[model samples]
Target: MSRGDAHAAVRRRVCLSAAVAWLALEALPARSATTQDATWPEEPDPAPGRGTPADQAPIDWPEIGLLDGRRRAPQSWAGAPVLVVFWATWCPYCLRHNQRVERLFREVDPARLQVLGVAVDRDERRVRDHLRQQGLTFPNTVDDGGLRARFTERRVLPMTCLVNAQGRVSLRIPGEMSADDVRALAARALAG
Candidate 1:
């Protein structure tokens, strides 16, 4: 073969090898740069100035402040699985995801799980009204942005993570997932 043709073949082989390597990297399970514990007291410390509300839930646990002047911490649900979703009112994916989540919430056994919705949007009124118009009965809170940023990876919307009963983050998902998918994820989270 001509030298030019040989060089072209070499380049093609190199490109193919690089593409394969990239795909292999992508297929691996994603672990956070900051490792999350799989199971109490081992949970990451609360981000400073989290702006959790004063009238927190009566449950004795870590207080994750809410929008309605209340807070529900992971500890509050002590021994029960906790699902926390970091969402925004304007995110279209979040709107659809919430609908699926509503169904999951209804079908799931509350004694085995707890869900926390954190709205990172600044306008509490808009967030509250939007959720109401959508008939979302699950409790949600408006974060001052700190808590959301802390847990968010890629700063994406509809990030969902599950803290197992032991206060460890069993799953940290960042993107929209179907109701069935979330249920499957939750099943694993709660089984802890």
Candidate 2:
């Protein structure tokens, strides 16, 4: 083949190879960094005022000490729907969501529902002060990665989950929510 013709053929071959590679990458299913088979499952497009169903496997809750010097055991609130919230002090979304959660805690009976807050922040004093200032009496514990891993791998702030009376996680929400939505969580848990 002529020199120019040979060069042109090589260029075309390279372009075709690049196109094939691009197509292969584009055809692959998109994988999120937060997804894990062992962790809680997620919905493609979660509906407003609703939470997606999480893993059916029952959660093995460890004995956790509340910031208020109280200790909570699984048997203490057995056969009750438990609301577990993973939050942080600096997260603005968590701040607002926590207030609505506090209201829900007060409105619902302890026998019907149990609320537990998991603060991912290292500052125990700040978390305690924030809860105290908000007049939130719900039991909360500061996590050093141990407790958080049992629930979710997503680092999203204000992650919430509803563990049913049987200790199975029923609903898993990964972001902030409205007051009405928080109120409906109890109804959803009881309805099942």
Candidate 3:
């Protein structure tokens, strides 16, 4: 081959290698970050009429059906810090966010921090398949219409809310979150 041709070939190979590396990295799960690795700011007091539904005194969360063919009554979680996530199966952001949540669920003591995923999709089978494919065992329930109304449907996927032991909503995040952010939220729940 000509010298020019050889150089061009080498450039092409380098570009291909970089592309492959990037894709592989993208497919890997995000590294779990401890709460100590990042700082979490306190949430500001909500303005009048601007509060989320869970912001109500002891959110009258209705009974929810679990994926495991069981029901979770609101009172069952009355005195525990519960992390409720509203997500859909097809949302890309939810895919990444749920992975971090799965990690947090596995790492923390269930008694200290209860995690619940509310799948907001219409197809129950799709939600189940997604959870099974992702190897996520955290308690997830397909959201019936009631949950959407009760949670006040923020029109955003992967909405994560932290409910303190007192049943007060402490924080509500409306989008994707980093590993440190998730950890810090759980840390705050544990501390509270």
Candidate 4:
């Protein structure tokens, strides 16, 4: 090959190699600063008018259906702290957030704190399956229209709200949060 042709070939090979490396890195589950620093969009607070439902104390657990064929009745866990996660089965961000929350859930004292994952989708089976796939055993409840409508229906999935022991919102994270944030919220929840 001519000298010019050889140099051009070497340049092409280097470009191809670089492209392959970039694709391989993208395919991996990224745990770098870019992924860690990146976060889902969030709101300072949940949607307005989600103020306590009539005859319901603000921040109290509303009646919702649990995954295990059981029901979560209001006031049953009244005095405990609830980390309410409003998520959907179809959201990839929700999947990632829940996996982290599940780790936090396992670490915390369930007796003093609770993680209530409220699935916004109508498909109960999908929610259950997703939770199972994530290996999350924390109590998950699929929101039956009324509960979700009363909460934020602004289309942002994976919203988190920390309701303290006295049935009031202490922290409102409308999108994805770090595991450290979840742990800090747990500490605040338990302190109340």
Model 3: residues with Cα > 4 Å off, grouped in runs = 1-55
In model 1, pairs of residues that clash are 61-75, 61-76, 62-73, 64-73, 67-141
lDDT of 2 by residue, 120-177 (tens): 9999998888888878888899999988776666788888888888887676777887
Question: Any idea what lDDT model 2 has?
Answer: 0.79
In angstroms, the error of model 1 at 92 is: 0.5
- The lDDT values for all models are 0.70, 0.79, 0.80, 0.72
lDDT of 4 by residue, 1-192 (tens): 999999999999999999999999999985643133323233334445454322234653566668988887887667787888888888887888888889888888877997888888888888788888879887888776666554445556777776667766655565676776666667767777
Write the number of the candidate with greater lDDT, choosing between 3 and 4: 3
Q: Model 3 over residues 46-165: C-alpha lDDT tens digits?
A: 444545434476667888888878898878888889998899988988898999999999999988899999998888888889999998889999877677555454567778888889
**In terms of TM-score, which candidate is stronger, 3 or 4?**
3
Global lDDT of model 3 = 0.80
RMSD (CA, Å), candidate 4 to true, equals 5.7
Runs off by more than 4 Å, candidate 4: 1-57
| Cα RMSD to the true fold for all candidates | 8.4, 11.0, 6.0, 5.7
Structural similarity to truth (TM-score) of each candidate: 0.63, 0.70, 0.73, 0.71
lDDT winner among the candidates?
3
Tens-digit lDDT track for model 1 on 1-192? 999999999999999999999999999998643222323123332445432222222223346666566766445677787788888989988998888788878877877888778888888899989988988877788877666554533476788867667655555566787666776776776667
